[model samples]
Target: MQIRKAFRYKLMPKGEHIRKMKQFCGYARFIFNRALAYQKAQYESDNTVKFSYTRLANLLPEWKHEFE
Candidate 1:
């Protein structure tokens, strides 16, 4: 038999950390929404379309250049 323990800690970020965290969160949301919209379009255009992680992974570099 084995025993396991889990812990959760609350975070209190400083000003600069808070700012960076917000920026990251915003960027993540933007990317997620963009990917979701694209998937939706593909589905609307053709019901047989498959969802792909590689497809979105390929878009990351282009998105970075555009957003940055």
Candidate 2:
């Protein structure tokens, strides 16, 4: 027999915290959109090209540096 315990806590974000959270969300959205667009473009150029997580993961640093 085994027993497990779990706890959940709600966030109480203040003004500054909310602002930072929004900024983080926006950055995440940007990264997702960029990745999707890259995949789309690659597919359009070569139909046989399948999605490659490793290739995209490798590009993350380049994307971050380019965007920043």
Candidate 3:
């Protein structure tokens, strides 16, 4: 007689919460960099890099409607 042990590994996030968290991160970065750009313009005098949604949408903007 022999006994076996099973092991499992997942390479990806699981469930809706994980998906939403990723999207929220995308959206949060969008909002942060956007706000940061304006702050930089007003304060930063160097050629430091900045970013925002002026490039692309990460999380869907429609999600905001959920809060409103």
Candidate 4:
């Protein structure tokens, strides 16, 4: 027999914390959308293209530089 346990906690962010949290969420959403769009474009351009995480990660620096 085995036993497993899980824990969950609720956040009660205030003022500045709330603002920072929202900012981080926005950045995460942006990165995800960009990655999805890249993958999609690659697929559309090349039917035999394979998904590569490394390729996406390698592009991050370029993206940051481009956007900044």
Candidate 5:
């Protein structure tokens, strides 16, 4: 007998389910971006770009929870 080192996936979903999934995905993306913006505002405001390392590291865990 031989062993196989491969895997297959089946992501088949109903039409309605797909549509709903798209909507949820869009909403989730929007929320994620908005949260990032708000998080940035705490340290920067002018809407200009700047390095924000500490802020990002501090918020990483909270962001993960939001996604979960």
Candidate 6:
């Protein structure tokens, strides 16, 4: 026989932590949406577009520079 237990706890972030969290979340959203938009446009322009992790990874530096 085995027993399992689960516990849930809520986070109470400090002011600075909250601000940093928001900033990180915003940045992540921007990267995610931008990648999605690029992938979508490529697919729309050419139906044979294939997803490539290497290509996407290669775009990260450009995106970071553009974001800055």
In model 2, where is the ten-residue run with the lowest total lDDT? 59-68
For every model in order, what is the number of clashing pairs?
Answer: 0, 0, 0, 0, 0, 0
Badly placed stretches (over 4 Å) of model 6 are none
Per-model TM-score on C-alpha atoms: 0.81, 0.83, 0.40, 0.84, 0.50, 0.83
lDDT (Cα, 0-100) at 27 in candidate 5: 78
Across 1-68, the per-residue lDDT of candidate 1 in tens digits comes to 99999999999999999999999999889999999998999999999998999998998999889887
Better of 2 and 6 by lDDT: 2
The TM-score, computed over Cα atoms with residue i paired to residue i, of candidate 1 is 0.81
Model 1: colliding residue pairs = none
For model 5, how does the per-residue alpha-carbon lDDT over 1-68 read when each residue is reduced to its tens digit? Answer: 99879888999999999999999999778766866777677547665556466755676678669867
Give candidate 1 regions above 4 Å deviation.
1-8
Error of 4 at 53 (Å): 1.0
Comparing 4 and 5 by TM-score, which wins? Answer: 4
What overall lDDT goes with each candidate model? 0.94, 0.94, 0.66, 0.97, 0.75, 0.92
Best by TM-score: 4
CA lDDT, candidate 2, residue 65: 87
At residue 68, candidate 1 shows an lDDT of 78
- Per-residue error at 64 for model 3, in Å? 7.3
Give a tens-digit lDDT track for model 3, residues 1-68.
Answer: 99999999976767987999899998889677765665577456656655556533543455356444
Q: Which runs of model 2 end up more than 4 angstroms from their true locations?
A: 1-6
Candidate 6 lDDT at 13 equals 98
